[model samples]
Target: MNIKGKTILITGGGSGIGLESAKQFLAEGANVIITGRNSAKLEAAKKLLPSLIIIKSDVENEEDAIALLDKVTSLGGIDILYNNAGVGSPALNLGIANDQILKNAVYEMNVNYFGVIRLNNLFINMLKSRKEAAIINTTSILSLVPALEEPTYAPTKTALSFYTRTLRKNLEILKSNVKVFELLPPVVATEMTANRNDKKITPEQLVKALVSGIKKDQFTIRVGDTKLLYVVSRFFPKLAFNLVNPKKIYASLK
Candidate 1:
């Protein structure tokens, strides 16, 4: 919970929320390591933050995950694992071949779901041994309220949300000090939403809220409109579903 003096690892830290989080945690006196597949972006992050230990690694690759553990172990194990690496589903067209759809879905799951599973399995024990530690998974509000636009992407988050909840409960039963936290962020102005003119919080704003939430020991850190979306989905599932999938409603209205 305490960010100071902690060793933190943030996947997909090359940009967006992950980059901002790495910088914020570094400001709080934490040893931060950021990993991504893009060497150019990682290099740029190093130039920008200078203090960040940037690693050119892909979470979808098991070998890269192992290499990442080795890299972090050399710097004294990680106290916080931020599972932030994720991919938005490719544009889904019903006209596309079924094989292509399946292929796209597999890649998305590999990075979004299996990546979290692998890293958690690898470093959970090390974190448990530490006095204070946390596993933060960056899910989305779409997990609670599915969006019509992201058919493939939304399901992955939904699955991860449940996985994180079940993991938290299991940790509690074992009386483990390692905390599990889910970061459900609303639409942010990132590469994931480059063209869309939707309302979005800046990555810095989300990171600020995230740090404050973590400090308060909030297990579910909902950023911006996500907090409202979560509540609506909880109390009014049907309404929430309709609200998020307005395009679907319109298509059916005729």
Candidate 2:
């Protein structure tokens, strides 16, 4: 929970929430190492934050994940592994038969869910060895209520949300010191959501809330509209569904 003096590795840290996270964590006095698939983006991020340790790697690749672990281990290990990399395919109607539907679902699941598991499995032992360590998984508000517009993307987060919760309980039962934290963020103004006109929080605002939550040792940190959605979904499932998948979204799809 102590950000100061701890080293953290964040995936997909070239821009958006990940980059903002690197900035805030650095300001908090933590050593930050960032990884992304784009070499140019990594270089740009390094230029922005001269102290950041940038590595070019893709979360979906097994070889890349292994190499990343070796590289991080050589750098003296990390106290936190922040899984922030995620992807979504273009909006498509799942009611119609289309090959893209399955393809999109697989791609989202690979990066958003399995990728987190791969990295966590590789680093769990190292994290346990640390005096204090944590694993942060970024799920979405859609994980609580599915969005019709983001059919595949929403399901991926839902699966990850379940995995994260189970993983936390499993670690606790084993008496492990490694802390698992699930961050459920609402729509944020990022490259991924650039096309959306929906209201969004800035990356800075989201990361500020995240860091504050981590410092307070809050495992499930819900930000912005996510907090409200959680409460509503618990009591009013039908209304929560309507809030996420409005009538306009259905009309647009049609």
Top candidate on lDDT is 2
Off by over 4 Å in 2: none
Which run of 10 residues does model 1 get worst, by summed lDDT? 245-254
Cα deviation of 50, candidate 2, in Å: 0.2
Q: Per-residue CA lDDT of candidate 2, range 41-85, in tens?
A: 999999999999999999999999999999999999999999999
Displacement of the residue 213 alpha carbon in candidate 2, Å: 0.5
At residue 11, candidate 2 shows an lDDT of: 100
Q: Write the per-residue lDDT of candidate 1 for residues 155-197, one digit (tens) a residue.
A: 8999999999999999999999999999999899999999766
Q: Which 10 successive residues of model 2 have the least lDDT summed?
A: 245-254
What is the alpha-carbon RMSD of candidate 1 to the true structure? 2.3
TM-score of each candidate?
Answer: 0.94, 0.99
